[model samples]
Target: MTQGLKIVIVEDDALIAMDLADLLIGMGHDVCAIASTESEAIVTARRCKPDLMIVDGGLQEGNGIDAMRRIATEGFIPHLFVTGDPQRLAQGAPDAVIVGKPFTMRELSRGIAAALASGVPASAD
Candidate 1:
């Protein structure tokens, strides 16, 4: 049996972040941290060392893509982008998974499962 995933949320929107956290926790995953800015996200991800990360496209301090890149370069967590704008994700780090905003719990669960199954390496650059 697969172990429960450890997750980190990087969303600027308080409500969305809380909702996602609640959903993931309800699904039996451990939420390590929730961050609203790029720097905080990166720091939290590094410190928490979670198995999965759900990041928003926009942040108060910087873009989520940049944070993803930094995390990748540091040889850390596998991450997915959750955003309303697919166009913004197009410019994201290569091979990054993009889960559109307004996603149902089922959709988010599926996306996380797929990302875990793929076993993709964390970004190296």
Candidate 2:
């Protein structure tokens, strides 16, 4: 509605990934990439240079914390943690605004708004 963000989604579950992508599109954001693994997430993030990343806290390989640890080093890209276990993500990514999984699109939208306003995911270092 306002100006959509270029976004990337790092999620392992294929159905969940598609749902997220749809939600982003409904919100008028462009989904640059959708990755299911840490390596893929990193590679796609670099290639896409997205304005924001909505990442699952856990993945089959390395998890979002691991991916963000690396992404942070390259500089800041705002990120939101969408996962079931908020506590786990909070411990790993204190600066991120986490949204637990099974969340409503409205709730996820709120989290996105907050993260965008926050600006720049904090460096893991």
Give the top-scoring candidate (TM-score).
2
| Candidate 1 lDDT by residue in tens digits, 1-125 | 23488899999999999999998888888998999999998899879998988889888889888887777777746677888986657565556677887888777877787666665643434
Number of backbone-clashing residue pairs for each candidate, in the order shown: 0, 0
lDDT of 2 at 61: 86
TM-score of 2: 0.92
TM-score of each: 0.87, 0.92
Off by over 4 Å in 1: 1-3, 119-125
C-alpha RMSD in Å of predicted model 1 compared with the true structure: 2.3
lDDT of each: 0.80, 0.86
Tens digits of lDDT, candidate 2, 1-125: 34589999999999999988998898889998999999998999899999999999999888998897788788677888899999877887787889997899778888888888887564374
Please estimate how well model 2 matches the true structure, expressed as its whole-model Cα lDDT. 0.86
Give the lDDT of residue 91 in candidate 1.
60
Candidate 2, 2: how far from true, in Å?
4.2
Best by lDDT: 2
TM-score of 1: 0.87
